[model samples]
Target: MALWIEAESVERRSNATEDDLQAIIRAVYRQVLGNAHVLDSQRLTNVESQFRNGDITVRNFVRAVAQSDLYRSRCFETSSPYRFIELNFKHLLGRAPQDQAEIAEHVQIYHQYGYEAEINSYIDSDEYIRSFGEHLVPSARGNRTQSGIKNVSFNRSFTLMRGFAANDVGKSAKLISDIGGNLPTKIVAPSGASGVYSNTGKRFRVAVSQVSYGPRVTQSVTTFEVGYSQLSQKIQNIQKTGGKILRVTEVA
Candidate 1:
């Protein structure tokens, strides 16, 4: 079982062969498109040609794919503002936003500068250069802890990843409420052979605060312990009851 799904890094070698170029093309689609199945018609042949002919660096090729209409329609137009920003971080930078400020900054940029600038901002970032360089493809760095990356980012990034087989067609932001409310995101391990679940049979405690409606309003706090499979539904139930989740901590 794999704990995380990583985009295979494909670098343009000085003496790269035709096979290498094809691999790079595949890698670009797999990474930038979030494992979405790309029909022949959906592929950027012109961009691939430029990459093959040594006309553009891998960075430029990544930028082109991200800017393409395919990416725009599937990811941007149909998604919420938060979802779009979230996908941009995952697809372009290979991670999740570190904090609310990062998400807010990108949202502000999109509101002011427009879509092209939003895409350009990630590609043109110093972090992008340092992490991926000009030739290497961007990959998920969520599973590994790195200096300067927040401890919470690992769980958040894994949330964005969902699972190895899951595509990025989901329209809602997975981390929006967590990031916006400054809440700690509980790491839910994915199911199946591709997903690693260390705490398979373990349980977690969900602390929630609920307000009762009546002539005299009263607030009550409660805690519920549930298995991994029941965690999501339990949270949904809490939200449906107009409850605010205060915290989710693993049971020892």
Candidate 2:
């Protein structure tokens, strides 16, 4: 529910102490790329140095991580341009886009300006500065005012560490585009739970184990089955925001 810097992490990221600044940088790497250990040490250090020197804002620091070859090979290569754009929103802007209009807008940016420029566009936006300054991180806040299924708030840190973006905008768009001449084909059932038949809405579980919510809270693990279609939609929303899908099946 907290934005980029939760009250606790904000303390460290916004402080005057050198140790705190270093911790801030570490958190940036850990949050942005999903894991700090996987980053090349030199690149991580360089990014930290850039931020410390005031040469780059927090947005720029994040963009650097997402652009790194490591991230590209792992997260972006196979991703649809929409998924790519959505991750930028989750990781750099800290929210799901307002609608399909926004997604198309970013897809245009990616196609026109290319990857680095597309990333820089989000970080350099006025919204970025308004929501979080040079010292904070991006985390999903949900489109709570929107009608239908979009009005959901995500646990911020939980989204940042997600594995990969899974939104199907690109696939959906392709499906729509190709719907005309060739007869629309039936969606082949997935072998297990991958692709369109991917585990969607029928499953919902909150990460009560993460301390990102701070010590003031108490929670027991909870689980629910949302059914495939509904869970699928929610999962797509989660994917758009750089979140992970952790399956917690209930025991009899």
Q: Which TM-score value belongs to model 2?
A: 0.53
Cα lDDT, all candidates: 0.82, 0.50
Candidate with best lDDT = 1
Error of 1 at 71 (Å): 0.5
Over 149-183, each residue of candidate 2 has an lDDT whose tens digit, in order, gives: 24322322123222233332222122211111112
The CA lDDT at 131 in model 1 is 89
Model 2, residue 153: distance off in Å is 6.7
Model 1's alpha-carbon lDDT is: 0.82
Q: Candidate 1: where are CA atoms >4 Å away?
A: 191-252
RMSD versus native structure for model 2: 16.4
Instruction: Using TM-score, give the best candidate's number.
Output: 1
